[model samples]
Target chain A: MESKVNKYSKQFILFNSIFIFCWLVISIFPFLWTFWGSFKVKADFFSRADWWYTVSGVNTLIETGGRSTLEAYINSWIEGEFWRAARNTAIVTFSVVTISLFLGTLGAYALSRSTYKYAFWILIAALVFRAMPHITLVSGYLFPFFQLKIWGILPTTIIVLVAINQPFTLWLLYSFFKTVPKELDESALIDGASYFQAFRHIIMPVMWPGVITAGLFSLMLAYNDFTVTALLLNQQNYTMVPKINAFLGTVEHGGNYMWAVASVVSATAPLFMIVMFFQRQLISGLTTGAVKG
Target chain B: MPHKTFFWFFFPSGLAMILFIGLPIFSSFFQSLHIETEQILIEVETCDPFGCEMEVQVDQEATGLLREESPLGRFNGFGTYLDRNHLAFDDLGAGWETKTSIRNFISIVLNLPFYKSLLFTLTFCFSVTPVVVCLGFVVALSVNALAKSIKGPVIFGTILPMIVTPLIGSLVLFWMIDAQGILGATLQKILDDPNLSLKASRNLTWITLIIYGIWHNTPFAFVVFYAALQTVPQEPVEAAIIDGASRFQRVRYIVLPHVYPVATFIALICLMDNFRVFEPIIGFSAEGVAQSLSWMIYKDLRNETLMLFGSAGATSMLTILGVAILLTPVLIRTWKEFRTDR
Candidate 1:
């Protein structure tokens, strides 16, 4: 029996090792390719592929093309307008997060404790609204403003984004708030603390993680979004994704491969920074709040 | 003490939602019912290399109508349902005409593109969700099963892929599949079949996408399942284990039932996200074969006669119903669990 158990244990270890290797290779290699490609010079990229590391002076010939891999990195930085796109993304993310956080917390508090007959309906309706594709809503959403001749498309977009993001934010915050002991509210009430006071003093601190999680998700969603921005923003007014997409198109059309790599790198910088900074919280929050909600 | 405070708390969200979400939806529904003059038809008098490829541009202004026809071309009271009277055009704008017939909705539902998308979404959701859940479950259960020393790194390693932006994930996949890429070269040799190019083949694209999506999304499921598993009542699991039930059997009877709610929740959100998926399709559509519902809506809006209005609205309604139907069983099961727990 002991020998059989040992054999099973060994087989399990071997199976797991193979699975882990495949999983790691599959998940990590793509990002690595992107990272490496970002450093390749445009001129040598194609040639290097055709005559890769022949080592009969091939490496030197590839290196002498007056183009460095780092050129794409620099070119993408300048040409892709990374700074402006980053600024636009930051503004959108900050505004959406702040507004939704405030509204979601309040709305969630109400839905959590208030025995209103319509609360469930409100939640379900919000979910349905959020579930509808943004592309479906873009024309109708922008039409009213178009008729009124309101040209501030960016601000209008932010408002729409906040509205769409609220459903998930509110749902997540409500769930978190519900997890807090209700006696906290009861005690605060006994002490003459109003609902607002109870929320601010008692529940807020407990639910801070949930609020942050929702905020991060909102930020990520806004930052990573491509379709709506592509449809709404003009060519001259490129967001991060549209800019990356343009470079991608250029590469597909056999334009500068170097520029494409650079664009991808610059576009992903904020994402990388956010992930590195908030890796743990982001993962946990993603599952609990975003997925589970 | 009074109801006013509750109103204040609830009213803003409700009102804002009504104005922003509800209002647009209803107005779009209304707009679908009107005759649109914005439809532009262009007639090209050309002597082509093959023959004269004459293109006729229909001007909506000629009809003096706000829309080409009432939505669905028929009149239903207040446009609450599909109308058949509004479709007056035989073929308004060359091969792309104002389809003001029941065929529009029927085609939207039954056509190859819609079915392709539906199949893609179903296979996608099913393929990805289980892999994610299983991967997540393994990571979560193993971590919980492991000694404290081995848990941390495994958890972090498993979660590393989930933090990157989803769009970035696709871009990264694109680069990896380039001809000279490390795996690309290896795959070129191993998957020598010409059909295996992840960039070109729709089936390959779907598989690659599901794999990438599962890799990115599993960590999320893992974390929730992990956290929920931690909260699962230990006594029942221990009792089952003590009954000489194997680990798999114990998990089947004890751990699975406990984790079912979280799994259902993840599955629900995943279904919605997958159904509305546009980015991966857009990213992967270099060959233009991957036309999803969201992409179709985008395409329809660009048509000159605005042929998309009825179909898009109908599609959205159908999609909502699909979601409701898909989630009903899970919803019922969840409600039962919650009630029993209470």
Candidate 2:
């Protein structure tokens, strides 16, 4: 019986390890391939005659007189003016994270403290808003923004993104705020502090972890957005994601598909670093609501 | 908090939501009921041309003035909703009358842009959600059994797919799976078909997209379930083990029940996210074979000649209705939970 149990367990472990190994390959190989291929010439990367050409870089040597080249990166970044889009992405994400947290922290704190039915209704309304496909909202925004003459600018996109980020931000921070002992703020209130003062002095210090996690998510939303930014912004004001999309359109004309590949790698680098550093917070943030429920 | 205090605290976020999120739904509804103005036409007589011919030409200035006067165009009164690009009510009625069979009727209905997109969107949503849940649970279990030192790195690697921007993620996969790319070439060799391309067929495109959807979403579900698995009570698992429950039986009875609620949460989120699967379609360039409702609205608004605001708006309204329907069960459950908490 003991030998039989051991044999079954050994089989289970082997299966699990093999499954994980395959999954890891599936998860990690595409990025590695793209990153490596981004350095090679397009001919070698997409070589139909020989797939090994991608690894050997024979075509890359013929085209660029080297095993790899930075020509794609230079072409995309300088000639294509991708830096402008990266700058715009930075501005948009920074402003969005700041404004979303500002509004979300105050609103979520209030919602967490209040016992009113309206507060519950507001959350439910936000839930509905969260479910609406962002393109649907962009459809509504186009005419109005055109009418107001605010289309094709950074501030307009930032404000719209901040509003869109609000629902998720409020929910995340609200859950975070719920975990804080109410007595922390109540004690400050009893000490003759105004409600705002209580929030500022008592609640703000302990709320950083939650606020940071929410800010990371908000930053990502603003950074990763394609629909709103693509539709709302003009050519000059494009963010990175939309700009990458625009590269797809113009690639065939210039035969600069490598520029797009290079830009994709460039765009994804920061997100890779972010995940590297913030994996713990991100995992916790993901599970907070799920585990609590 | 007092009402006065609470009001001030909530005001900024409330105003933002009201202006952008709340108002858009109403604006989209109103826009859906209006179509663009018709071009004004006037008779012009050419005395020397073909013995005094009279021609009707578009009066551009008059048309511009009309458009400027009412930018929402003329009130359409559900006409946009019933048009061929949308519900295609007339086409549906005609097809119904002349139907050869139910399958033919269904095919005819699906040939319409709206129905075609709806079918893909629903298929993508429902198929991706359950698979993600199950895959995630299995991955979570596997990872949970890993040694402590390697788990963090494994998690960091796993979450990369979920964390990267969807467009870029899809593009990375798409380039690999292009006809001449490594994976595509390998697939051709394996299948022994020189001309085979995943992008060439409708069913294959759908499969590729669904596969991409599963790839993109499973990590999120995995992360959530992994965390949930960590919190699974040890007592019950140990009790089952001591009670002579086999490994599978222990997992089935103890671990499954503990993580069931988290599974539901992951499913809810996956459904909501997958229903709006637009980016992958673009990245894969699968719009020729498959389009989501979001993609339809995007196409209308991006029309090269003139923006089809009314058509886009109508589709927006319908898509919003779909979201509401998807959300109904969760909302009902939340309402019940809220009542119980009170």
Candidate 3:
């Protein structure tokens, strides 16, 4: 019996080693390749038959004619207009996150704690709404927006994003709010605090976990959105996803690959920071709907 | 709580959904039924100075009447939905009827934009789900067996592919598939074909996109399965081991059953998500080689002069119908669970 256990453990170790080794290589290789390629001159990136040119020969930065990747970043920031796209992304992410959190907290609080059975039905409706492909929603928005002359504007897309994000926000926050004991805040109303005030002073601090998770989801949604913003926003209002796509088209057609890689690298810098710090929250936020709720 | 409290609390999100989701769904349906047009008239201007010009102009009164009839568009109920850009039922029937063989018939059908995109979308959805789920399960098991101290970094690495923005993730990998890029160069050398290019072939493009789909989605499934693994009851595993079961037998009888529900959950979500594959084709600039249902809609709306809202609206309806078909089983199952629980 002991011999069998030992033999199985050895097999398991061997299997796991192979899986992890393969996974790590596939996960890290592309980003490392892109990161390396981003610093190489346009000629090497496009013309050279060898991809090892960056490491083998003197790697020249495509932007600013420098020898370092820093100039590539600067060009992405300035010439590629990623800074503008970043600023637009920040505004959209911040607005969508804050507004979704604020509204989601209120709505979820009511939906979870209310004795009214209709609140449950409202959540089911939100779930259905959430399940629909968002392109359908964008298609719906086009004509009304064009008729109203509100199309191709940042605020228009922001509001649409907030709306698309509502169901997810409410669903995640509802589960989060359910975890908090109702008695904790229900007693505050007996002490003369209104429901809103009870929610404000009593429940707000405890629900931070859910709020943060929902905010992370919101931030990721707004940050990574390509479909709606790509369709709805005009050239002047393009966000990071669409902006990088534009660079991909323009540069790939023009035979300049460096700018596209540089822009992608710059666009993803903030996400790397977010993942490093908030990996736990991001995972929890993503799986909350699946596993818990 | 007062009854009015529900209203006050839910009003904001409720209004947002009404304005955006609820209204748009209704509007999309209505838009699918309508086809907008300009009321045009030819005006021949005769100038006294011996020059005459003829110009086609939009008839303002008639245009206003058209807008008044339906601000979204003129109500051509179901016409756009059946047009050559959409269902094209007659054209499809003719193509199928005229073909000499199955391969010729398929080629004819695939030439239709809507059918071509549907072919790719369904192919992507059906292929990616099972592959990602199985890969995810293996990774989950492997991660679960690792030393506790090393697990954190391993998980972080696993999640990195998923964490990158979808467009950028596809682009980062799309660069490598370039003819001059590393993998492309390696493949060229390994195969001894100097002229081999991923971009130059449709079949290779589809495979690369499928591989990208699996690469991007596996981590999410892995994370979910890993979380589910923590809750797996250990007694059955131990009992099976003591009963002279092999490791494979134990996994088959104990561990597999434990994560079965999560595997199903991930499969359902993956099906729904993969049905809307859009960004990769755009990111790779492979629109010429591949198109998705979502990309098809984007194409219609991005037309140079006319936005083609009517065509986009019809395609959106079809996409919504596709999603509904995918979602029905899950919805029915959930409804059953709710009924039984109550």
Candidate 4:
């Protein structure tokens, strides 16, 4: 038992611990520092006098009459109109996730259950589609969209995002559906239920875990998207990622660097919470396809 | 499933893909074959103080009418693809004819915008993927040996870099490495060069972006590899240990084979993702130093006054071609596997 427990040498263990400690610092320090500095004024955050000024918030106190303030948050959310972008993001993500999962489950269920050669071909075609860089597809959309007068609307962006997300969502859900026994659905079919009926009544309840996982990924894709949103949508319909990008352009003249920082922290907060609560699901989703392969 | 059932099940997804993803490739190809119409010019006679003068002016109304009439513009057939900003066939021929040596020819090729971006994209993709795989494996192995109590928090910290928005993650690191920020100041103090800036040098910018790529992507590989490591069969490891195998030997023999498939999967994903690297360039303001294929298309479409739709379309088509080439190996492998399965 002792030999089993102490398999590695003491020196090896020491080195491993040190390496992990360094890695943790490298991984976590940037976010911690940025989160801490988001509350400070620009002068303190990017202090020329001393790095310690950031930690102590000396310049923040001098500028805002306190150790820290919500000046940047208020400035970004209200003055910069980041809330509109946040709302746009909310709408886009909700629609994309719901639509993607709806279409994906049906398609993936068919692909998984079928042994036909065309189903394999469809999956392969999806693989190719998934590999295409999204910006390339956006370039193709611009001319037609401008002609159709649908270039800058939320629905256009949602539909395009759902399309772009389908290949991945389908692939993921197909793998998950493959894991579920075919007999469960076939049994329902033998009882005279139609395919759609079996899918709705028999399969969906057991499919939530997979649906939620795929939904999470689809949500991330829509939320973190910049290329599709930036290129397809007009300024009024900008999402948070592109809106944060717009903030960078105004930073030089408006001195709104802290506002951008505050917005970034705000944008990351939800993702942080999602990670905290759904770490297991996230990990499982990432490895699902790989494990099967 | 019957054909009818399958069609009904797959209709919505197929329609979406066909309309958006499938048709766009053809649309981009068609758009790439043409350039926008030149501004319409008309001669106008004006009476000056001395004499009547003839002047040529752009007729915006006529140009607008023409654009409205035929938004596809006049066909230029493969002209846009071979232009200086794209494949640059003429420029390559010129460089080949005038070069003094191989090195000089390589420099000339890199001088072209398209090839320069291609080089950077390929360099970024190849360099970042392997480092990420290796580092991720090491981290996975190390974390797997840690006491279980701290594993959860450690994993939470590890994945933060990956799960955060790429642009935001890069911006976070960008601030910390700004000239006056903590890391930047520490480096300047250590080197005793107050004027030192990571953003100023081209090579340094490349290295910084590559480092950012590795940091952002390593966590994904780590999580996958760690999960794979968890499922590694214990019997083989126990037998090897009973046979007095060294720790290094046991790992080399037992663990590596188990994780090889996961590593390949990681590499494939890394290559695909890294090829489309764009947001970091904007976040780091490194556009002056490095650009990727996606960034090139973005620049073309984002032109302030007149969007260069044809130029962007040409680049988009070529980028799609590059993606096809990158995917060929995996596609071929899948094809072969499919055949064997049949």
Candidate 5:
């Protein structure tokens, strides 16, 4: 019986090991394809026969001074106006994440620690707001904003992005805040630590992992977004993902392998870097997002 | 600082929420009733390329006009809801006429397309959620159960899919299914027909979409389920195993029941998501057949007619009605669960 159990356990482990390896390979294939493809020249990208060569057969893709991978990277950077999108994405993400974390932590504290009459109602409202789609809300805002333009149209678009991302940011941070025991707040209170101070000190420190997870998720969301950004942003203020819209039908647009390589590289690199840098936190944060209150 | 005097802590967040999130709901309600319009100059140009000055006419473009005291307002006690409802479906196709009879809404609820979409959505929700939940649970449990040495890789490998952007995945999918794509080429060869294609048929498109949805969504579901699974009481699972329960039996009787709350939560959200499903639909072009309520809403939003507003309202109404009908039991159950627990 003991030997049989050991054999069964060993088989289970072997099965799971294979499963994990397959999962890892499939999971990372797109990112890997885009990364490698980003290094190819425009000529190499377009010729289906050239890019389609089997791995065992040697190809001249590397030998002929084709726009090597590094050249493609440089062209993608310069041509895509990626820096501008990155800057906009950064500022918007930082502002939204910061404001959301600050307000959400406090609001969550109030709901958790308060003797207020409307705490439950506030929590319910927050959840409802979280569940409401961004498009529905943006539809109403579109009309008024159309009449009142701001800062030659750029700042207005960024502000709209901030507003759209706020609910999720708040919801994510609030979830983190709720996990802090009420007793911690009471203890801080007994120690004469004011609510603000306790939140800033005790609660915030303990919830840092959750906060980082929420903050990063918010950043990922803001950065990867296409729909609202495409609608709200004008041509000059186009985000990286929405820039793909330019490729839809234009001959100069979608035909080049260089552009495809550039797009995949520009979009995926930052996310890949972030995920690699903060793998644990990203997982935990996503985990939180998956479950409900 | 005092517990009772912490109202100041709530003000900023409350004010922000009210201004941003709260205002939009109210604004959507108000905008639905307005005669909305945009001035457009129709440039009448001969087919001369870049050599002609065009005559422009300002079309009488007062649009999205609401009927004063529309009967819908009287029918529903909430005038705003009625106005919103009128605006959503008023402008659908180029020449689509309004069918305001009670029978139309009933038909919408009971029609083949509507019901089929619902069934597809429900199947998607049921199958996808369980697969995700089970995979997530099993993976997390296995990882947790493993010797400490190999656990990290298991978790890392499972989550790599979740980290990449969906846009990239969709693009990669495009390449993988396009005629010259790896799978497409392989199939063309295997079938001994040069024209054999995945995108050429509706059945194939739906299959690809279902596969894509599963592939794209599994990572998300896995992450959530895995996270929830991590929190499952180890003691109970161990006790079940000690009682000589087989792995499947343990998961069924003990693990699944314990994870029921989280599963229910995931299911409700998944239902909402599966129904909305605009991104993948737009991305994959599962063709027009992939139209969900949200896609219809998106289509309506794109309509040049003040019909956009009416269509949005109609779509929203349909979506809300659908979700409310389907989710009432779940919500009631959730309420009961929350109540009983408290």
Candidate 6:
């Protein structure tokens, strides 16, 4: 029995270590692979033999007298208009974050503070909207926006994005606000502050973590979104996600895909920074989003 | 809260939602009833004995007027929905009335664009979600068993998939799985067949997309379940061990049940996310192989000259309805939980 137990335990440990190791590699390697592949010339990266030469790209650089890491980055930036897309993405993300946070907070605070059934139903509506894909929402926006002649503009897309983000933001913020004591805000109201003032002073400061989390979520939803931005934004207003997608379809450098790899890497760099800085918040925010909705 | 306070607080978001979301729901339904008309210019030629004369004739000028006057054309209620790209009542009828054999009829119906996309959508959701959930639970449990010192790096690596934008994440995987890429080459080598390419066939593409889905989403489940695992009780496992429960049996009885709710949570999120599986199809260039409803909407809406808004509207409505159908059980359960809490 002791020998059998030892054998089983050893097998279990070995299995788990292998599983975790594989999981880590599967999770991390594709990204590092693509990031590394971005630097190589088209010929080198697609070469069948000595693929390590692809990542190194030094031999190819010497042979062709061109195409290095900096070359790919430069080509992707200039040819892809990386700055334009990045600027548009930044403008849209920040606006969506600020606007969604403002509205989502007030609406969520209202729902959390109220004792009415309407709050419950309203929240359910938000949840329902949240569950539907943004493409569905964009469908609804098309005709009306066209009639109003506002299609494919930054503000139009921003408003639509905020509206779509509002549902999830409201859900997250509602739950977050529920954790703050009702008495805290009410006490501020009773002392001297008006309702808005109380919210601005007491409620916002009290639920700072939730606010940040909700803000991060709004930024992410706007940033990572492909369907709405892809459809709504005109050529000049393309965001990073859609721009990267457009790169996939167009022929470049004999279909090298290095520009695509470079675009993917550039688009992903900020996300890496975000995950590193806000991993805990992101994890908790995602959990709250999952469990609450 | 005071009524005025509530009003002020909820007003802006409520207005935004109503204008953008609430109105759009009704607008989508309304738009679905109406199709847009193209300004088709027809040149009619009349040949005389002396010479030939050409005169420009405008057809469907009323439609052109209507199209110009209103963003929505004539309301043909339920017409777009039942058409070939949607419910395909005509195709169904054609299949039923024409085909003599059952197998052939079934094939005809499945070949309809609407039904093919619906099939792929359903297949994607079903195949990806459950497997990802199980794999995620395994990873979560494994990581939960690891020492504290080593777990953080493992977790950081794991979250990278979930962290990276879905489009970029899937693109990375797509590149790796290209026939000439490292993983694809290695896979071909392992099979001892140079022509063993994943991108050639529909089945292979579907499998590759599903694998990518699992790889991308499993970490989310892992994190959720890993977090849940910390709250698992120590006493029950000890009692199970004392009762001579085997390691597997102990895990089966205690650990699995402890994580059941979290697994269900992951499953719900997975199912919903997978239902609208649009990004991968585009990233993989798998539109020929896999066409999802959301992608259908994108394709329709992206018709540069003809927006196909009515068709898109109808598909969007159906997609939302599908989401509602999938979410009904979860909603009911949550409502029950809320009532119990109340």
Q: In DockQ, how does model 2 score against the reference complex? A: 0.62
Alpha carbon deviation, residue B67, candidate 2 (Å): 1.7
**Model 3 chain B worst lDDT window (10 residues):** B38-47
Model 3 stretches astray by more than 4 angstroms = A1-8, A57-69, A190-192, A252-256, B38-73
Most lDDT-accurate candidate: 4
lDDT of each: 0.63, 0.89, 0.83, 0.91, 0.60, 0.83
Task: Summarize candidate 2's per-residue lDDT along B76-97 as a digit string, tens digits.
Answer: 9999999999999999999999
Tens-place lDDT digits, model 1, residues B1-342: 346877787676666677767787765665455433344566868786888877786654754353434333443333422332222122222214545676674454433455556666677777887777777777676556544575655565666566555666666665555555444655667767534556666677777678777877877777788888777786776676568777778778888988886887877766666766666665654336556666655665556544545555544554556666776665566456545745
List RMSD in Å for every model shown: 6.6, 2.6, 3.5, 1.9, 6.5, 3.4
Tens-place lDDT per residue, model 3, A1-293, is: 33232244666788788879899899988887777667767656654466666554344643445664555567777877778888899898899888888888999899888866687678778877888888888888988898899999899988899999999899898888888998888889888899899988999878988888888888888999998988898888899888887776665444335777887877777887888788888778777777743
Best of the candidates, DockQ: 4
Q: Which CAPRI category fits model 6?
A: medium
* Residue pairs with clashing backbones, model 6: none
Q: Each predicted complex: what DockQ?
A: 0.36, 0.62, 0.60, 0.72, 0.41, 0.56
* Residue-by-residue lDDT tens digits, candidate 4, B242-278: 8999988887999999998788878988898899999
Tens digit per residue, CA lDDT, model 4, A1-293: 44373367888889999999999999999988989999998998987668899999998888889998889999899999999999999999999999999999999999999988999999899999999999999989999999899999999999999999999899999999998999999999999999999999989999999988899899889999988998999999999999988898885653488888999999989988987888878889988966654
The interface RMSD for candidate 4 is 1.5
Q: Of the candidates numbered 3 and 5, which has the greater DockQ value?
A: 3
How are the candidates ranked when ordered by DockQ, highest leading?
4, 2, 3, 6, 5, 1
Looking at candidate 2, what is the lDDT of residue A287? 83
Error of 1 at A143 (Å): 2.8
For all predicted structures, in order, the TM-scores are 0.79, 0.96, 0.92, 0.96, 0.79, 0.93
Candidate 6 per-residue C-alpha lDDT over B1-342 given as tens digits, one digit per residue, 9 for 90 to 100: 777889989999999988888888888888899887656678889789989999887667765676788757667889999988899888899889999899999899889888899998998889889898888888887887776688777788888988667788888888778877787777777888878876678899999888888888888888888778777787777677768999879779898988887788788878887888889888888988789999999899888677898999999899989999988877787778778878
TM-score of 3: 0.92
Once model 3 is optimally superposed onto the true structure by TM-score, how far is the C-alpha of residue A154 displaced, in angstroms?
Answer: 2.0
Please, what are the lDDT tens digits per residue for candidate 6 over residues A89-138?
99999999999998988999999999887788888788777788878888
**Candidate 3 residue lDDT tens string, B1-342:** 688988999899899999999898888887778776766575756566778777667677877776676666667888987778888888889988899999998898888889999999999999999999999998988888787788888888888888787789998887788777778888898999988887789999999999999999999899898888888787777777789888778778888988887888899989998998988887676899899999988888788866777888889989989998988777776666656756
